[model samples]
Target chain A: MLEGTMTSTTEITHLTFDVLVDLLRKIFVRHGVSETTAAILADNCARAERDGSFSHGIFRVPGYISTLKSGWVDGKAQPVIEDDGAALIRVDARNGFTLAASALARPTLLERAREQGVGVLAIRNSHHFSALWPDVEPFADEGLVALSFVNSMAVVVPPGGKKAIFGTNPVAFAAPRAGQPPYVFDQSSSAIANGDVQIAAREGHSLREGAGVDRDGNPTTDPRAVLDGGALLPFGGYKGASIALMVEILAAALTGGNFSREVDWSQHPGAQTPCTGQLFIVIDPARGGNGHFAERVAEICDLTREAGQERLPSDRRFRTRAETARTGIPIKAKDMALLQELVSE
Target chain B: MLEGTMTSTTEITHLTFDVLVDLLRKIFVRHGVSETTAAILADNCARAERDGSFSHGIFRVPGYISTLKSGWVDGKAQPVIEDDGAALIRVDARNGFTLAASALARPTLLERAREQGVGVLAIRNSHHFSALWPDVEPFADEGLVALSFVNSMAVVVPPGGKKAIFGTNPVAFAAPRAGQPPYVFDQSSSAIANGDVQIAAREGHSLREGAGVDRDGNPTTDPRAVLDGGALLPFGGYKGASIALMVEILAAALTGGNFSREVDWSQHPGAQTPCTGQLFIVIDPARGGNGHFAERVAEICDLTREAGQERLPSDRRFRTRAETARTGIPIKAKDMALLQELVSE
Candidate 1:
């Protein structure tokens, strides 16, 4: 088992999926969350951990607890979906977890895409705390092309600016292949993800050049400089900055939610929610007719693999998913202790 | 007036819009292209030149003529649009320019989006010349969000492979604003466009580090090394590579067109057509009811400007467009000579 924290005397544990989900569900339920909401949160967290997204997995428990306790998130809130049309939907998340909100709207969303050839869903007043792939993968599994964009708290400095004016906004796209795992990808527009920098600082590692900048806007490789008031740079310079702007508009502006800078975190104090907006698009590829969509997707995958270079987008996640399913999830001893304390309280 | 090359004498020449289009049309028609096809080609090239896209403008005419003469492109071909449903269309470009095909498909595509909230159009068996902005900009101008992706001949080496397996696949996105020029962006997934590299090689300029690699897959800054047998690297590493794959799947795979490697230039001899596939998507933002779609797009622009930093996408395009409209377009000495020779022939 991996070591957790230096002060932890407890030994790390390997827990089965059922055990982990049970613990997560108990923790949320004890804290006033509805059984259904708790189950969704538990399943999302478990899947993140199982898929090796450590940042979004059990690592996020503390943050979720903080937000729920501070009234920033409604533990028992039920997201309501308004079907504006055959192809358009809006989910009023009621300041609930995006996981729960997306889950609530997914059935009708998928049905709409199947019938209409395309479906657009706008999610507002939600806190997105997990990886995006989990949200889009289900659609791909159903033989649809899916895209998602979400805008978060501002931490990136747009090109030509010295101050942070945009979020490390992220976009995701997924396409399905017959008899194979779908091609899926999610990426932040920032030069480096915030979690990555935090990990680098924890490991006492210097960042790659151009990852971020100091308070004065001079580039720095020091993770501390970036975390302590500095800002991350947009990836690929202005191209990435433009994409970040697109996401901000698509997610925040189109959803009638707060922009990255518009969210007042000072009011929430230490307990903060992303309080973000998200856009999810689903397209029925068959709508364009059976125009060799499956074959083309397969050809791309075969070419990538046959080239003997570059792993397919979902390769790692699928591998880790299998491993985690076969064995179990490993929880650091210190993290388990922290969860145990919450359970007792 | 710009200059024209005469070996012994170089004379500058400035041509108004009417003059350029007339010259281009005459040249193409002289090469056996139908008058209608020639006019479309001329209008697209003239617009590209006016917008400062030298690579796609007059620089591309010789290639178009070569393809027409070789019979690889049917100069008189008419693209047929098959409207399978209210939300989907497939355009059989009939071995003609994508510009002509898109023009033929634009009206129905826009109408479908306005009625159904979304529209998907796939163009197959077409040669895409000129910048992508012209295709998507019109949709944005009509108050829709437009996205286009096209895959060309492979020149970019996927990460971890020395051989080129992908094209300089480009994706363009445009969002309309109420009264301002739309937010528009077009980008190739390669570290540098092939044209840029060739120009650098001719100008004896070194490429930026990580732009491409030598034949052995070793990184190099020498443009000649990259232009010769070496291959261009995808921008932003794997993220860009993934996007390139997405474009390949959506364009080539979904459209049932040839993949990058599938196109054999040897068969066509001197005349080469991109002979590529393109996917276009148009979304009606108003479908997101009460989302303040136009206001949000405008807010994004206003915020970017009021933040006291950064040039918004399409800012330069608008400025250049206005200036070119007033002063006309200037052709370089050598390029002007080439055009004159084509016209005279």
Candidate 2:
């Protein structure tokens, strides 16, 4: 489905998901990430690619490599888990990637949810730069519901505000459904995602109305203007702004990590990752004694579709995942060359 | 600030909060509600009025009286709590007001949050017809973070769909702030709240663009059309629709309550309330070991305002509350007459 001709006759390269993960893992390890952390990061990025989340896939590798080379993030840092035998578990990522920290704490989080009926995982001092769905979907796979929030570097302004004080904060939710993959959604509080803005700027495409403001804080459609000292607006105006604020509180304040505005990578010129925090809340649906939880989810989903919502959130991604599983993940030949070059650098 | 001359002569009545609550309680009791349930509902409604949330306040009294007269909801049904000695607590509201069930379960919920670091309250078979802020704000006042979701009758449709299949589902959140009132926000996933639409319809006002659809599922700004066989649209297009879906899953599916689509109130002619479910997830921020959780929350709020946001969610309500405490809650003279009539009915 992703097959497309690049220039006049340039062909698209297709690779198995495993092959893509292995290739990306080499790039990460070469950029100073430990083998363990590289595997996790590579798998996450590859999964995004395999699921047609191209913005967060290989499109983000250069940022990862740049941030690592700038010494802003500790690619080899070991995360320390702080659990007081409570349902809430805290992890100090020690300036490492959030994926690694969450990976390390997953078992404890699952145990807490199963035993206590609900569990919360708070990770601090970590850099998060990928789609949040990859973090929460696995819990739903285990028959539990999960929600995750992550705050990024400030690139959004409050309504009618000129100064940027909020991030493109995203909240993701996942719930199991009967006879199907989990229902998942990862959406940014901003009208448009930063990755999408970057892609728009690269492709010289205009943004939608209400998507962003230029440097002067006036609404603008030029993606380049939005990238150069401009900022994004929250989705749905004030309602969406409130959500962005909530994400900051949940992921940053509650987790004891830096707020989006506090992320300053000025000294590290090439640093692109936001060193903030992330929070996860997982609940065991069985605790509610609702034996038909998954079936109910499926029912609502089917009803939504029947009601004329042509596509539900994650529908396209799941469909793409299946198609790619058979046809292999499609990538531009030039991008493939960049990955090969990244492996050596 | 609420004082205004009606018809150029009619005066606005002012009453202390306690006086308003007492009047409302009498009204509820006269309409067949038990004394205990009446007191709880009265306080909630009065609080909304005192805080200038008119939609869920005195404005709803007539609907309550009508529903009571129709014998739609059990005015004195006793809610039963089901405990499994886990962090999750289920409360069968027994077809009664949700307020009573939540009040009955508050102590246990608080205890669970304190002990387990997180608590989940699932209330099913309950009628919720008021502002959600009143439900979660107190948790923040107690220095905990709380989130609540409630689904109502199907007065909203999925984006671009003709049929009404979703409710104006609302999600409320609260968190304590340093040296200030708790930060709270209650927002409907719909573009505009159902209550607001009702108010607009009564006040002869037009809805904002994208607020709703007409009986034929065509975009409309007419309040009456939105009220009669039409439906509200989700805010922010697909993103808001996703939130509505999540609320359904969290509030109904997980709580073992009826989905919004399943609410069949045709037999109960005057039923204005949706007998569905409500979910509350409360967390002790201190459990994250973030000693300055409240202080951090305060910092971010201040920054948001300084960045040029004129007001944050619940700002007007909090300000109005303080003002009312100093002076009195302002009520239209006509509404006072209606209250008097309700007391004798």
The sequence of per-residue lDDT tens digits that candidate 2 reaches over residues A124-223 is 9999989999999999999999999999999999998998989999999999999999999999999999999999999989999999999999999999
Off by over 4 Å in 2: A1-10, B1-10
Chain A structural similarity (TM-score) per candidate? 0.92, 0.97
The prediction achieving the highest DockQ against the true structure is 2
**Collision pairs in model 2:** none
Tens digits of per-residue lDDT, candidate 1, A185-288, equal 88888998777787788789999998898888889999999988888999988878888888888888777777887777666655556787999888787775
Computed on alpha carbons, the lDDT of every model, listed in order, comes to 0.81, 0.93
TM-score of chain B of each: 0.92, 0.97
TM-score of chain A of 2: 0.97
